[model samples]
Target: MKIMSVFGTRPEAIKMCPLIKELQSHTEITSVVCITGQHREMLKEVLETFTIKPDYDLNIMKKEQDLFDITLNILDKIKAILIKEKPDLVLVHGDTSTTFSTALACFYLNIPIGHIEAGLRTYNMTSPFPEEFNRQAVGLVANYHFAPTEQAKKTLLAEGKDPKSIFVTGNTAIDALKTTINPNYTHPILEWAGSSRIIMITAHRRENIGQPMEHMFHAIKRIVEEHPDIKCIYPIHMNPKVKTLATTILGENDRIKLIPPMNVIDFHNLLNKSYLILTDSGGIQEEAPSLGKPVLVMRDTTERPEGIEAGTLKLTGTTEEEIYKQFKLLLTDKVAYNQMSHATNPYGDGFASKKIIEALLQNKKD
Candidate 1:
């Protein structure tokens, strides 16, 4: 079976890279990767780490590309590829515009779609903005729903999706850790961290811009000011609003290093070295738990509630006081820190890629 795997962005690439490798190893499955180039430099870094050169690169990234630009560019570009390849199954990951647009194009062509990391929901579509809608919309057309957890499967079933089509394959994000993380890895950032604790921060959610973001930064700034034994590394997002807010609030601090986003290998190694994580992103909620790093999620709501249930994450709303309170507790309370850091990752056991491939192959057989 010829399976065309479609993804863009660093998060999609990181999760899908392991599955792509698994697909290529099987003689019975022909795997093709198509990158939307939604993110140029960051995406390239991830691809190089996995040694994955895409069969097709739709260079869709532009100066301040908005949601409309991404959707249309992918729709226009991916259509041509789909016409030429016409794979037996088209696989899409998570809830990026690439995933949604690619799946829509496939549906238009009557091509089968297999959605990876499917059935994540906040129900409040505006919370995660287009992402909540993107995943739910893709769920409507996907032939195979590869949910990350049992909770995800239940969500799909509750939404009236066919149970037979839904498969709980765990999360591919966990599988990625096995490949990207290196125990012996060393970088200048690690050296600069010295004997002090490293607090890795990644906050780039669309909804949390403006005042909400200011609140998060203020919390971080307060923590840094109070705690001299800690250093914070924030890989600022490409968004100008985020950058400006971060620079105005966090840039002045010598202890907080505002660097460009790190690649999968470097990011994974950094996560391994991190004493704690504060984020408002989705994938990190899954990734940090596997590394035994306690995460304080800087968001009001999250679709990935499995981490909360497993005791690896806590939801600190986008408020200055709330974030500061949670941040300080983790630093001060050893028992609380250890409990969260040591929780079992409900996401996967590093076999998600194999299971997903097996499901695909079995679908072909059936």
Candidate 2:
């Protein structure tokens, strides 16, 4: 069977790379990769790291492209590739404009689509902006839903997706960790963290852009000031707005190291070595728990509640006081930290690629 996997952006590339490799391992299957290049330059590093080259590159990225541009560009260009490849099935991952657009184009062509990392829902469409809507839109048309957890499956079931079609395959993000977080991995960031309790911070979400971002930054700043033994490594995202805000608020702190964006390998390795995590991003919510790192989610509402219930994560939201209090308590209280860090990862055991492949092959036979 020939299976085409379509994705854009670094997160999608990282998560999908494991599954792509899994598909390649089978003698009976041919894995075809198509990149929309929604995140052209940043995505190349991940693809190179994983050693997965594309049979098709849409080159859809434009300078300062909007959501509408990405969606329409992908929809227009991918149609030709889908027709030419004529894959047995198409797989799209997570809640990106590329994911939704690829799924929608497949729907228009009446091709079967398997949604990787399906069934995540924030419910409030505007909070995550279009991502919440993107996943929901893909859910509407996806022939197979590879839900990462039971909660994700429940979301699909509640939305009336076919029972047989929805499989709790665990998160592919964990699968990516197998290749990414290596024992020999080294970085300059690790040098600064040293023997101190390293807190890896990543906070840049559309919802948390202005005041919310400031609140999170201030809270981290407070924690660093109060805790002399702790050090932080914040790999700031590429958004100029986020960069400016981070520099202004977190600038002069010796303990708080504000660095540029890290590739998946570096980021995952950092997560593995870190004592704890604080983030507003969706992917880290799933990935950090598997590393036994306690996460203080900086968002008000999360699509992944499995971590919270399992004691691996805490929702501190974007409020300055709330964020500060949680950070302080976790740092000072040994029992609280241990409980969160030692919780069994509900996300996956890093076998998600195997499950996703089996589902695709099973459907192919049917």
Could you tell me how far off, in angstroms, the CA of residue 67 lies in candidate 2 after the best superposition?
0.6
Clashing pairs in 1: none
Model 2: CA > 4 A from native: none
Task: Report lDDT (Cα) of residue 84, candidate 2.
Answer: 89
- In terms of TM-score, the best-performing candidate is 1
- Estimate, for each residue in 1-366, the C-alpha lDDT of model 2 and write its tens digit: 889999999889999999999999999998899999998878999999999999999999987788889988998999989898898789999999999999999999999999999998989998787789999999999999999999999989999999999988999899888888888888887887788989999987887899999999999998899888989999888778899999999999999999988888888988899889999888998888888899999999888889889999899989999999999999989999999999999998899999988877777679
lDDT of each: 0.93, 0.91
> Which candidate leads in lDDT?
1
TM per candidate: 0.99, 0.97
- Candidate 2, position 133, lDDT: 91
Off by over 4 Å in 1: none
Predicted candidate 1, C-alpha RMSD: 0.8
True-structure lDDT of candidate 1: 0.93
Model 2 RMSD in angstroms:
1.2
